[model samples]
Target chain A: MSKNLVGNHIRKLRFNHNEMTQQQLADKVGVTRQTIVALEKGNYSPSLELAFRIAHAFHLPLEEVFFYGDDPTQ
Target chain B: MTYQEKKSIVSLISAILIFGFYCLYMYPQYPGGGLESPEAFRFWGSFVLILTVVSIVAHIVISIIFNIVFRMTTREKEPNFADELDKLIDLKAFRNSFFVFVVGFLLAMGSLIIYQPLHVMFMILIISGFISDVTGSATKLYHYRRGV
Candidate 1:
């Protein structure tokens, strides 16, 4: 079975959005700061609703926030 | 650390301490040289009852102290809800611990086939349950530290 990888531009987005802290972003998306830290570190994959909420927090489209593919760093 | 992580650490430590005490003190008191004993029922029944009460009170006090210390040190509010990641970690931990419990249970039953002692089986069952809980909490803390 092939593994599915989900990646995000959370760190970049946070920087672009006036250098928002992980806690701030987490607060915006109604999640714990540890979740945001995990997302930024690529240690976790967010749910679809959470993905959308995170994107909405930064006023970005879903694709701009997260991607699913082999190359997580891209 | 998250509240769940902190709670897991507390549980793991307390489980180890309690069970270790049980093994060192209570386990040796059985009439038989080994774990099997007919008279063990009364001792185990009261032992378990007292342990349960102590564990509950200890956990409550520890949690309260931990929360107060964490708030004072970090100056941060506790997250009111278990988020998706927290739930996911919990599910994974529980799944792993369930296997440990089932396997331990089967082994305990297998022991009964050989010894045929009901009280021994009951004691093993209780120990297995405690092992499952400790394993679950340890796994949750591991995931929190190492990533899920």
Candidate 2:
């Protein structure tokens, strides 16, 4: 499968935040757990509004939750 | 598999079964006159119309049953609403399904241009509709398993 450029730290961040479950984060962001699963697996890129919602769920800035390349900026 | 994947598979199977059983049930009722007979046309018309209604109602019933069964078996409630990912996947599935039906429609029309019998056109159209339904479900299954 081709790689998706839009990478996210949702999985790690979810763990950092009291080991939040996929369902919990999904509820926080107003999405299904399947969407969170897809994001963690790099199988989907969220729309801007959804991305913002996810970021907000993590209490992080957009860039802190998501990155545009294979590697995150230091 | 996730609920979406299971639902997609159930849908695909249901589409095939519904079309197959409907065809089997209706096959013997075809008019015995010439294919071009008005009675033949009437049979074909009612076949398509009744099939449409039957399939729609059957699908709705099957979906409800599937959801109930899924919740009972998995002990998890199905998602209450569609989210962005669900909508996106649905759009993609619809696009593919619509494309298939359009192609099939054109081919069916082209068959008439080639001097094929009217019954041939009717069969083609009916088959196309069934295939399109299957395609939509299959597309959803593929994307759900492989991710969109």
Candidate 3:
């Protein structure tokens, strides 16, 4: 299987946003705090909808929040 | 832990308790020696009683503990995909259990053809199937939570 690297800086974004917590981001994005933690740790890749929500939560464009990161799709 | 993880733990504990009770107590001590005993009603009553008590107690304790610890936050509502994944895991786990049941049933039938006492086989098949499903689902939930 191709190990397409998917990465995000959700933690950094949260920090930039007044040290926003995973719970806060999850509340804003309508996802679980655990999901935010997973995304920040690169342990989970969000769906398109979730991606958009996260980007919106951070007040950033989708590309700015989530990067494919040498993904095979790219 | 996620809701899925908590649910998995509860299920696994319940299964273990049921399997243990069946294998250790009911399987050997019950009337009719698992199948052919003339006191089938008595055996069934005991089995049902034990199962109900254990399940109820375990469920209550698990619910209480889950609520106190991980279920504290109302912000993390269960997601749709997470619920779907749980159901999918449950179905897959049940399929695994069914496979065990089928194998046990076949074995029992073979023994019957040889005039062997196959009474215990019926109980064994069903209980084994349940055990298989419970363990499989618990493992899957653990791996999923671990992000494997």
Candidate 4:
């Protein structure tokens, strides 16, 4: 099966936001740290609501936080 | 690990151990015995009662102990909420477990057609239900560890 290719800048955003920890971001977004870790690892694709929530946690536009592409390696 | 993941692990272990013990206890008594037999009926009746009590007690104790240990080690209070991702993982795990139950049900039906033993059918149903629950809990734990 083809792997899903949703991508995110969460790790970078966290770094930029004064070295925010995964747990901190999770608390901000009302999710478990594991969910944030999964998103960072690209092992799961979030629902639209979660996607918006993550973006809101970082105070960024949705596109700036997440995007769809074929090359997740990038 | 999350609280739900820890709970699932405990539940899966408990189910396997309890069911294994039940099978061992019943095996010697099951040969040539039908459900209508007073001895078999009484054994099953008491077994069900004991299993119910044991399962409830074990779950409560394990949950409390794990919660205490987790809080002590992590200094983070246990999260009581199931977030959107956790709910989605639960749904996915349930979908995977539903197929296991369907297969078990089909096998039980086939056994009913072939053997036609009421006691055997009942045992199959009970075991199948437990297997489904174990599968669901295991799948949830796996997803929690491996990501979902």
After TM-score superposition, what is the CA distance of residue B24 in candidate 2 from its true location, in Å? 0.8
Best by DockQ: 2
Model 3 chain B: worst 10 consecutive residues (lDDT sum): B77-86
User: Model 1 Cα displacement at B76 (Å)?
Assistant: 1.9
Stretch of 10 with least lDDT, candidate 3 chain A? A1-10
Indicate whether candidate 1 or candidate 4 has the larger TM-score: 1
User: Across residues B1-148, which tens digit of lDDT does each residue of candidate 3 receive?
Assistant: 6666666776677667756765676666656444555577556566656766766686688666755665466444444454323444457666666776677678767667788764555555556556565757666565556542
Cα-lDDT of candidate 4: 0.80
Q: Candidate 2: which stretches are off by over 4 Å?
A: none
- Put down candidate 1 lDDT per residue, B15-101, tens digits, no spaces: 788777766776666566444454666777777787777667877887788778778987987777888999998998899899889
Q: Which is the winner by lDDT between candidate 2 and candidate 3?
A: 2
Top lDDT prediction, candidate number: 2
CA lDDT of each prediction against the hidden true structure: 0.81, 0.91, 0.65, 0.80
Can you write out model 2's per-residue Cα lDDT over B1-148, one digit (the tens) per residue? Answer: 7889899999999999999999999999998968799999999999999999999999999999999999999998899999988999999999999999999899999999999999999999999988999999998988877778
**All candidates: DockQ:** 0.48, 0.69, 0.26, 0.51
Order the numbered candidates by lDDT, best leading. 2, 1, 4, 3
Supply candidate 3's per-residue lDDT for B32: 41
lDDT of 2: 0.91
Encode model 4's per-residue lDDT on B89-112: one tens digit a residue.
Answer: 789879978888888788779888
At residue B51, candidate 2 shows an lDDT of 98
In candidate 2, which residue pairs clash? none
